[model samples]
Target: MASELPLPLLALLFLVILPPLCSSWRPADDDDASVSRSVFPMDGDVAWVVQVSDLHISAYSPERSADLELLGTALRAIRPHLLLVTGDITDAKNQQRTTSRQDEYEWVTYKKTIDAIVGRGGIDKSRIFDIRGNHDMYGVPYRGGKLDFFSTFSVNSQLKRLSTITSILLQGDRSYQFLGIDDTMSVGIRFPANLFGHPTDKRIEAVNSELQYLTNHSNAPVTKVVFGHFPMSFTASSEKGQRYESVFTRQSISAYLCGHLHAKVSKQLWRYHEMRTTEGHKSSFWEWELGDWKDSRLMRILAIDGGAVSFIDHTLNQALQTSILITYPTDSRSMNMLESEKWSMRNDINVLVFSHQVIRSVSARVFDSYSGFKVVEEIPLQLVFSSSADRPLFHAKWNAENYRSPSPTRYWLQVFVLDSHGVKISSEQRPFSVEGKMAIPTRSWLSYLVFEVQWEDMYRVLMWSNMAFTILLLFTPKILYHFVSRSSSYQRWVMSVLTSPIQQRKSYLWLVWFLMEGTRSKPFWSCLVIYVLWLIEMPWFWGRATSEDGEIAQMYLSGWSMPFHDGGLTGNKLSNPDVLVITLPFLYLVVIPVIVLIYGLFAEKAIVCSRRSRRVEYSAGSANTLAESARLLPDAPRALLMKFSGKMVSMVIQFWGSWTRRALLLACSITAAIHLKLCSKLMSAYGMVPVALSPPLTWMPLLLLGAAAYCTKLHGD
Candidate 1:
């Protein structure tokens, strides 16, 4: 049955969806009303730098037209000396076309956009520098007609040459270096070359050469700035999962600017900062991933005068300033006083709160909600010590009695610190879940027996079933053929012969059939058994495998971990199996035809042997026997049985091949699922999965269902 939605609810949904569009519709006003502009006073020769990426321009259209117009107007007014347009300048659709008509219409449009900005007079041509992106390799083809676009443009003499992935640019007396890297879109941290048809080593070497060039040529001290299409760092993901820093540290790079990620809102900017101190230099890398020009596009203005660089964010008519603040710990105190030094049931946890401002009187309270507005007991504390530091760190401890309440439930500790004037300085809160320990269970020899029995029993049952099916597939045809080949008289005679001791002793026919069946099933079953054992022994096999310290094992197992690890598997590890899967399927198909040829040869041999035996018998005056043999030799039933048997054998072989392939695939999927499950469990066990952030484990069953679907697809195909 269909249900209708209420009008009010439908209207509410529509209203909720309309605000984003309405906000986007209104263009940015030429004012600093929403932001503080006074903080950034422009006095020096500093101009805002706006990095544009993945423009993907084409001959004037709705999206590109608007983007070009807005960017052109904004750039003309700002006039930043160092404007870096990073990658994807042109969208190359087809690679097989001729050079002149090589479908660079997008690049042509991009050029026109640039021309519109700096004008046909070429006044601003020197200010705009372009780095090669992935799409630039469309002209050159590699193996199987795949294009190596980055190399093509990178080496192109008409285009600018920096380093392979890093280049240095010197502006006036102040030097600024730019490092342009290949894409880092992969599961590992190191930059991969296949995405751009270049080797990571070669790309890195190119960057190194550029650094060498800068070192040899430049005489003045330089503030290095790296430029790339991909962000060097990312959050909510692993560090070894992407290239977070420059490959080399020869140059003193201050900031890294990238443009792959588009900004959604005007005021929001993603800023990641890291500090590094070494023998020669102490520096910080500020990664500024510029927003897409189409949406929330803002330029960065850097003013350098008297050996100092100040970064400012600006639109066409307004600008904003940013600053860095640090906080640290001051002193430690307890909320509730305890009689003894150590509590019997629980341990006390000290809360250290670091803030940017000065703090005075502090209060510790037990709270109902996470915010701690409704306090259970407000414990006051005097300031034992104070410090004037960029990062002011403070501490408070929670005693066991403070958490002991009549409610018999989980509670949270909230600590608030105020300044001398009683204004709220800093606050910190943490939730604690309470649970009672249970008695440990006793273990005996029966437990070990039960565990072993379950696995062994299952293994034996599956193995026996597999062997039985294999034997039935092999010998059922031979038995039927033997019965059908003999006439009624011959059958009776054979039965009489079988009763004779000498004849029964010479009956090696059954032994031959047994050998043939064994030959067919043994190899297949052995392989299957080995694979099953491997599946069962997965944990032990992986437990002994070692990777670099702090390196995620799943990444290495899945063939996506960094090559920098001491014992990590590399790209070659993945390529070998991928090649085998692609090439072996055809080899298996060829083997089927060879098997058919062998079967035909055996059938011909049997025919020849029977004819030779009958000829000898006829020559020896056994004419009656020969005539009877001839009459019975047509073997209509045996021929039909043989045909049926061949068909069944073929079907069994096909099914076995399909099932084996499917089993391999299923094993892979199961391994992945187990890895993911273990990772989830580890996160939960370590309390890294926050209570507020963690979702229910309800999706686990769905994942299992999806794995089943994948297995079905593997077998069905």
Candidate 2:
């Protein structure tokens, strides 16, 4: 059967297709320059660079139209000498089936977008370069039937295809050169495979080959630049592989630029960036992990004038800007100081000094503040160098004059190096001491005691309780099943007890009515008097006194001597104890009292049911003797015995469940406690003690209370 498409669906598709076509046909403007501007000076020979990545573009849609307009406007305004579209220009293509109409449309739209970009006259088409990002190679094949999709769009011969592994050389007349490499995304490699199909070793070889080829072919000194879509090093992959360093070493590349990581630029980006740059060649290397255009939408502009490169970063929304300048030093040197040099007391302390021209030809001063007094007197120092160029690596030796005997306390050595440029780089304070006296102990015993107490009292209790509770909750049903299977009589008893109230409802109602009459006969004032008397007598048999205060006092006193005099039993009386003793006894006593009260209220109802049954049995006139009545009465006892058995079985199952629950709960509580205790200890050891109050210990108590309440509710139901 053939299905016909709905007209409304077709209309909807038509509406979606109309806007893009209209946008594409709209006349192109060559002079629009309102969007972005170059920061480089007008007369200077500048290198205008544009970076684009993660395009994810498909066909000419409304989204693509807006993007194209912005990009076109920027190109006209900046009039960049070169543009680099780093990677991920399109989504992955489906390779298993024949190319579909959608794929063809997407490919055409992609070509159109590129054409529009290149068509802008401000950017030199020859200088435009594209690097294969992960998405560019989609639909390519791998080992074991896996498809490498990024390679599909990346290798198209119709467009000016660029290699995934490549470099460019910038020189006069021959302003730009492009080197292309393969895609790193392929099979039989490690998890974080190379962007190019080749392994890192092979890639390095290729890069070296390309660099050597360019160096040999160029007529002038070429400014070398390399581009990729991933940063050489970052937090996530800092320890993963060696591709970053390997590629770096293979070529004397000026700057390595990449963009996979969307690192937040504000917090510690500068420090990490500075650390990654080569030490002596710091100005020669630069990296930029361009942020996403949709969210952060940041871009970088690199302007080169002769040997100087200036980088400016900007947000897509024009909300923020930052700039940095890079220049190679015309002359530089290295210096090393001998640590074995010793100071002498005979020479005036002022005679010791070191100097360097690059470090700015300024006098040096050294001071040793070992105690309250200055150990070394003021010293004047001079620098001697073989030549001006050699001054950068000059070193000086200093011997402290009139240096007295070592002080018994630790001291700090402060060195101040001042330059003619007014730049002062200070070394971290160095600590030294004269033959040592005992050092003052910074840790206190009280802190240790508190930590130990918390671990034992709070942490252990909570961990154990949690473990016990979890186990009990998991195995409760099985325990119940086992109890029920043990005795048929118990099962019968439970069924009878559950059904008894339903069978004798009418009798229960009459008995309740009789009790109301009896209560009504009593005077209200007399009844109140009797209640007061009962309350006055209840405490004598039910109440128990708590001694927690005495136990607490005892615990506090046992570890240290007290100012007040303490005597045998008096000391015990002053200590605190657990309050559970008094509370538990009172709770147990109240249970019996409640049971007695209930029995009294229901006694009349039971008697009425019995009399009714006896009358009916007599009317039947078969075996109506006392022996039969006795036999019938025994049935009640037998039923009760079966019910008792059922209850016993239930209690046994409940006990196991409850014990397991308590054990689990206790274990979890202990684990949590230990974690907290360790944290506190670590914090204290590092001198992070609170200046005010301490952490509250109420959580454990609250947890236990909640668990008890939950268990009580479950058991009662």
Candidate 3:
């Protein structure tokens, strides 16, 4: 097999298998690439900006509870110098083309949320800046909302078409030159942004003119930063692109910060050709994009120390503290105190742990600011007291004596434990810093892995067995059928119940197979019982052009909701599949054929009685006999009603017995069940969902199988 090889096949294998194996891949994490600025008091960094974007605040949106509280909490916790909101201020819910007026509810909710967050005084009105997003425009209905977002926030003074907010404080020593740019077209929302954008030549000229003025005046040493609502890449056409680099690169602008993509931390250098530049093209400008606050629940503290700019990533998920509290050394107090005191290395640090799990192991690791962060310490934390009386108080006193780094340091604790579910969980790693001469603390890493899995756990075993049992139950009827066919008594019972040819020419219709005397089940009691069950489901049947609802099956059905709708019979109703099983046996096996049989039986009896006790029979078939003998009955009124009822039933069976019609019913049921199954994207690992069929299609297989057997049972096919 190996000797006979095709060259094309061998080449195809090479083409398919080598690229991913050879290429380097990096695992994505939440914080590794994040960028933030810090206001370190020790380093004399006086100011930092916190950016939040895309607050799609709907007026009638459901409360997110704890998530809603994160914005204010994270902001207050961060204690940044200012907050910058780039775009997307409102949610513009249900906007329409005819709706000219903006929804005021969104603004009201936005104001309330912002006020609640910034009103507590750590942050205030003056420290916040905002710009209008496409949602703020009310010109085009769903695509746009209102143009008063900036005015509402009261940051209009900072709106410089090509001007700058000068002399803004930065690292206590350096002045910050903050420039603002508007790069949005409201009426079309992001439509124009996808192609050629609003013209940028005038803005570029104005910006360059100001830069010349500053250079001519020999203005104080400053750091130039620009903020905008959109990115250059958003506009694909060159003729309409914002040629920021042409002006910014000429003026030597360091960074361009924008927030429209709601992107996570990614650092990319944009290289572009400068118009009429003596220095040609260079990719020196750095673009920093921020994530959204409303959906992402993200905020950052940007700290710039001399030439080193660091971004600290923060998110709502990272802050979820479920009883895993470091009580003694509070997040705010402990780290700040350590940095303020400027401790190099100390072993006197203590931490308490009482996570919602049984402690399997606990330890602490320290990061050194000196020795390139290699000088480290690890200490096996001892459980001081663990009794049923109190929540097990485990303590870790990291011995930092081994770490002789001559700089400030940071430390974090790692606790591995088994939760009530016997699953291992690791506590969130918190970086506690001690600012010093040489502290190079890396970001804390927090995660855990389960070392073993118990295969025979009760929940796991019970769930698997349940799935096995359900699969077994589906085959039970067939299994019983095979065994019952072997028993003589069972065979006799079946023979007695099964319909037989009583008349000379028996109805060859497969529809009459599950009845007695070619009409109904043997022993009138069985026929009456089965017929009533069928009648119970009769009102659900529909004779409509639109196939949305029906007696047994609906054209359009979803989930566990619809199959049959007969509110009169049952307070709620039976599902289409349930109704199908209940009504089908009676429809073909007993109901329709039985009605025709009884009509003939009574008509023959009436004809004979009317003819002076002489027997009369028609050779044409029962259809003509039914019409002829209907008049000979003694009770004329009762006979008329029965004739009408039988006629109605015959008309239904005419369509009902056709394979095409019933197959369609079965098709609808199967389609609905399949749609429900395919619609679910995930099978949750925690809970087991049985492979049970849903409405409209659940019993399609059984019904169709019976119909198939019925149709092919005769040799005529």
Candidate 4:
């Protein structure tokens, strides 16, 4: 059983420790180091790019057809200045989705879709940029090889290399640079193994080179943006001290756009990573992740209006007629303020509204959020004549002097539009500050900022947490046994505080304690031994890898290998921290706990049954003695028999009296069931490879637990 620790103390410890875990590692101060001059000088006030990710186009699935048609239609309707397809251009799985492989047909389908769109004049081929997702690289032994369908069929491959760099020079001398980083593993192992983004040192150095944009003049500011398949958290650090985050920060990238997490998290995907550079200059960049285009039908329109970045995530559907994005005065929540803040002098509210049909009218509304979001004023916006009729840019003149504020007061802005066909749509209310000060983020923004996981910290946390938990499991029981058995006053007082009153009541203490005693069993000890061995000498998983010679099955071990050791067996094996950090924790934390609970359930039941059987045997023996006494004294025979019968009946009733133990058994069963269900969901969500793979981490726990449960019943009292 689990020894008692104060819940509040544990909670307090967690609260104290976790803040530093989340906050401490980033390098820069909140106020980024000021650049001597502007970095984003646009020919015009507005430049927008469309981003769509995780298409997962499949040849066998009927759903992909709809997605393809939608993509073509969207391209024609939106006609964005640039289109960035972040990754997962193909779903490399069979019809059952049970196995993963790089199917050429899926790539062919994706390629044909893009080719059709371009042929029909949907969008220019030069503007369309695509990159590789984990799914795209499934079973790819090497880049641009026979198995490399992406390099053969993808849009970027036809026009450029695996990674791309594009420079758009506008009407004036101003320009924008778009750098796409391809960090997918060079080896491109099978799925479940090929999860993290692995960028080589050469690739990272090349990225830095691409970012070093210099024009004829030294002061020329080219707005810089980077796009990649993986978020910084999912990306592994490169060899030779190269880091994607450091490069981006040092280069003063405007923003990093990515898409891999589909629609699992919405606003929570946004994060601003701040850190101080090696030069002691404060720097930071925003990581904006978009949802998938597969299931969510999602796409983002990212705009830079006078160097201030703003975006809107739009959902695609048949009835959806229009999309609206307010470019300037930019949303006050925009954090890229180091380069420009022209809102103070701007006299117009600029909005980009795209529609397939003729627009009837457009209007803007302002609300004072500090005054309980009461509507302050409404103004009609006039469509700019110079703007294209299809992608109409709407604006309305407003007096900036009236709304200027020295303090951080907040207001909400929303745009409403009605098309010629009577379809009405409105944009989500955006919180803004008129004085160019950062507005107080509303509930949605706060949730995103606070809850989004910082991936950079995640690798270390997962590795260390698994290590801590394993150490505890291996030693906690032995330590408790030593202290628990002792009869010192301190020990007694500690035991009373931990278990006495709480143990008497039906509480979660039962769940904890149930595993404590159960840890002595072979099933528990076996897992602990395996975990320790895996942490040190054993390989956690056996997966396939490719070399120039041929394909071979490779063993992957646990523990960290971030910079990757050179020229040894350790370097040759797949000991990536990214894979180990995830898989090791799952084995130790989730699978092992369920095993312990199930083992305890049957062990506890056998003990109770044994005690009941002993009491029955004792009662039977007393009844036989009473019968003998009654036979010897014939006069009181009946009375003696009646007394014996009553005593035996009472003993039987008393045997079943421990309802508290029954409750514990019931609680544990439910907990195990819930954990198993969660395991099932995860397995189904990620697919069957690693979840239900060989060496049997998932099913083996259940099997060993079942064996322990069965063996307990066979052992007699």
Candidate 5:
């Protein structure tokens, strides 16, 4: 086969495969290694920042008021150097989660609560940073308009723009640089239609410019951190087709902190982005997604000890007694090695404890993982510093040079805290390495899910994958039917696998045949009609129209509006594939086809079961044996061939008759109903009418579902 290939074809193959194999990659150099800085200190050199996100304060929810008060209490207790609220400062939705509307009272409440907290806690307004999430941009026409409540009331609004760069210099000349990015859409379309982070080309270039300026002027060992509202996966590309990850990797960001998806989405979303730049230097960073503060009352404490960074997410409450965070000798499994070398060079193990009660005792417990994590040594730590407002610091001298090894070895460490009342609280035992190595085997399996997935790359994959899958689903059956009569080995093999009684014994093969058979049913055609009609226009909803230059003419948007196209009623130009365009098509066109196909399967099953009493069915095992024997001996008899065909029909009928399959069909219908309702609400937010209720904004899905169900029953009868 290789010898027969054309020269151009061979050359093209090598062109596609050679570059990645030939490239050399190495990790980007750390700032600490290049710059001369003071040796790691015991105290004062370390600083902590507090991050609280998705507060969603509103008049409808009373608990949010208490959450704000609890935050103030916690801030007074910990007294972090800086505070970061990473967007969705106000819940932009009504009491019902279905509609999206911006309320100024909500922003006013947020502003007042934050002002009270700042007054009570003595936190400088300049040290606090806030950015916008999707909820923050609902139904706004432009950036600084009267409806842009974020511009009027947000913390960063005091400085003119929400996106900002702020630097803090700790004792010993150690600097921490924080970059806040605002990637909310310019038009601020209504939600849940505006579900992605959209940054203009200028915004991306501005970020690049700011980071470049900081890198050029800064001489001290700086710990760079970026804060934003959206995770990399949820953010869309800029108009210039640039992503934030490229800037983060090039700038050597320590971590990108965010919170949009709360606890239910995933308990913890930790992504490690390792990239090789075009210049052949490898760089990496961590994207840490914290839980929401609305319901969970979550807050994150991020500490920078020397140049190393570590963080802990904790729930805030009125009665919480003690919270502990080990700053020095960071966790082996989670720390980014490229960020700092201080972890291996530090001579002391330091822990910060925030408590209301007087801390009477502090100790460090070490365990040997090779010996079944048995307790090996317990070092008594002393209270190094205690402030009336800030958290107390405890330290113990230890020689990191003594624990160096040829390869990585895990050493589990835990800190125990005892108050004056004899209440003991301990930190979770986390593995660490003196060699600054990773504990690969002990890491969570979910961490691998986040490895090496870039923002722009994932966006393209989602866009192309949806298009490819939809086209294949619609065209495959037609193509297969046309070629079924040809003498093709591949087709013959596939048909044999789909039809053979022995092969049909496998559940997955039967499922494949069931879906394949369903495309020929009447319900599938009914669904395809609606789906094709949806594709013809792709109209979502109607709303106020705005131009590219922030011009809002009371000219209302009408007719079919394609979000993907530059020419539209909305007057917004969007060329790249975003979550908004990609996800909406998938929910409407892609999902309905799948639901109808499943209903077709159940309808066919119903017809099969009605005729069960008329004909006797054969056992799959016995029938398969006879069928195989007849195929091997083709000249044996015609009666044997007829019996084989009948056996196949009976086997297929049995495949559809299982109680498990029936239950699954019913479950799929219920799931489809729920999915349809969700899509309906999303569409209605954009001006599309619903199926049942007056105003036509909330009932269309239920009506369509009823029609599908009625058609299924008619086909069955």
Candidate 6:
């Protein structure tokens, strides 16, 4: 029995660390996300394209939909070669309910906005393409809005739609070829119910069939981009998507564009070094997710010039008539910019950066990749390669050679630009591989040793596993003793322990209480101890962590927020540390009493089972469900289960339920307010809702507390 518990307890402990293990590593910002280099086309025909997604049009707000119209009107003047809408054109989520899956009004609003995105600007409707998002499916928790999404675009006859289009400019050359995927799924009332990627096998086959056709067509556009609603990580989590990516690696694609995670952009780049059969080899594409227009008003401008692809983030100014085209380092995206500090002093690495707004200041920051990303040198880029009176060009030279390294140093150049308008923006993480005493990677595209897993990372995992198993191993003996020890034997043991007649009766009774009920009662005090521990741990965790955890990182609404890693939830989720704090108090509140009730109900069965092993045969009528003693449940475990469940339920109702109706209502109202506040924080962090809205709502819990106290004083009936 003791052996039995170690395995289960070890399993339980394993569950404890699983959150951080499988978690999606979320970077706080673009600078934090840039450990790897951006992948680009080495050579290709030039084309300028604009990609936007996750409209989430609210029917209640025409001004919200008007922003999309304003962007379309402005883009017509810029005349980008292609315009693409990835997914979630409609906001199906009910306005008030966090638990709501979708509704119809948002769908109708999206239908109108889609029209606005492709209005009369010489932008053809054929050039625009869209696919279904998880919100479009709206199949989680509620199924009423499943068909509502299709009404926005009535072209689809089947549930799933697939489309491939190639656009050509005046010269009749292949501009850009786009492949659209309808990858959507739904379940119910689960964290992963809607967010977990579940691609059907048939859909995978159809997508593969299309890719095969593109593979055969040599005249196909060299710049290939696949537009899907879900991010690559989400898709790969599915069985169908795994098969699709496997086939996709063989097919040379420039980029995989997606936009389910709005208000944020994530880029993941990887290189294939396999010497496998295929005409196309040695190419990589970065999956770029654009922010949402509904709240963020952000769009992406992808420019393909011959052999290079550069992306610029554009913010739509609703107050102004035209869109604001933001600019940064555009020239150095393709070249071997990764140079050693030794080489930098010998030969200057020229960086060309231009912005639409008036210049303020520019500085170059060099980060050491080897030494835990320590800033080896920070130099203000004073050497202006060129100056402009009307438009300011930002340029800076760093003394890279001054900080030369013996080993190949992994460093990156980040240019911070301040505009005259007091707006500051950072350049994309330009991670450079400096050649040094250590061998440098020569591959044109940056590569990291993924297969050569970092032993440190593995060791950390194993260390946690061992620690958990050992901690649980410590508790196995007690659990076994509790399961086996009988009341009479326990009493005898207590009497034997009281051999010291000098011991007072009060001390004896206290000892008995400590022995029997300490485990149950200590949890109450443990909660208080945890609060103090959190105070100690907060600073330690802050200094120790590279970034805060999960949705909390994006929205630190409270001074008392605990970090929980994501990826445990389920899209990139549409998903702890204050986990022990959040969990322990509830376990004390709910589990201890439930456990005691179960033990009381099953004590009879335990004694009966123990007696069975001691040569005592249970008679058919003696132990039968119909004739067992009334002191115990006369039936099986089901009867005991029901009796204990009733006891636990009755205790809660009899005790806590004694509160007046107003107090009960106030408690429920406060709890509901807290739940909505937490949900809004996550939704805003995920870019589903406006970040501005989250701040006002973050104060809801505090307001509710004040209101509760006031109501209590008023003594409302």
Tell me the number of clashing residue pairs for each predicted model: 19, 65, 23, 9, 6, 7
Tens-digit lDDT track of model 1 for 77-151:
344445667765654432321111123455545655676766631235655666655445322222112233333
- List ranges where model 2 is wrong by over 4 Å: 1-45, 58-65, 93-104, 142-156, 159-162, 173-182, 186-200, 213-221, 233-244, 262-284, 294-296, 317-717
Q: Which stretches of candidate 6 lie over 4 Å from their true place?
A: 1-44, 99-105, 139-146, 151-175, 186-192, 219-221, 239-245, 264-283, 319-479, 482-717
Report the Cα lDDT for residue 2, model 2.
14
lDDT of 3 by residue, 212-269 (tens): 5545564445556666665554321112333565667667555666655553433221
lDDT of each: 0.37, 0.35, 0.39, 0.62, 0.62, 0.43
Task: Encode model 2's per-residue lDDT on 296-407: one tens digit a residue.
Answer: 4556655543433334445555322112211111001100001113211222111111122234433333345544535453333344343222112222344422332344
Cα lDDT for residue 705, model 5?
A: 48
Ranking by lDDT: 5, 4, 6, 3, 1, 2
User: Which regions of candidate 1 are displaced past 4 Å?
Assistant: 1-48, 58-62, 91-103, 120-122, 137-168, 171-173, 179-199, 202-209, 212-219, 233-250, 264-282, 294-717
Worst-scoring 10-residue span by lDDT in model 6: 29-38
RMSD for all candidates, in order, please. 24.7, 30.1, 23.2, 8.4, 11.2, 18.9
Per-residue lDDT of candidate 5, residues 1-717 (tens digit): 233224323333443353321011111111111111111212356788899998888779968865677777777778787798988888877777766677888988888888888987677776677888878877666567777899899877765444333333344457676777766666566554465666555666666676676578767677788888888877766544678888888888888998888765654677777787778788888888888988888889998877778888888766456889998788776764643434446678989898878899999988877789898778888877544335477899987776565445557889999999999999999877666776544335443443234444554455445544554554454244334424467445544654467634677655554544555453444445345334322333233322222222221111112233232224434212333343545444535445544545444554455445433433455556666767766565846676767777767666665544455457556755665565566544543332223212223334444455554442333
Least lDDT summed over 10 consecutive residues: which range in candidate 1?
Answer: 30-39
- Model 3, C-alpha of 616: deviation from truth (Å): 57
Q: lDDT: which is higher, 1 or 2?
A: 1
TM-score of 3: 0.37
Off by over 4 Å in 3: 1-46, 62-69, 95-101, 138-150, 153-171, 186-199, 210-219, 236-242, 263-277, 280-283, 317-717
Which wins on lDDT, candidate 1 or candidate 6?
6
Per-residue lDDT value at 314 in model 4? 74
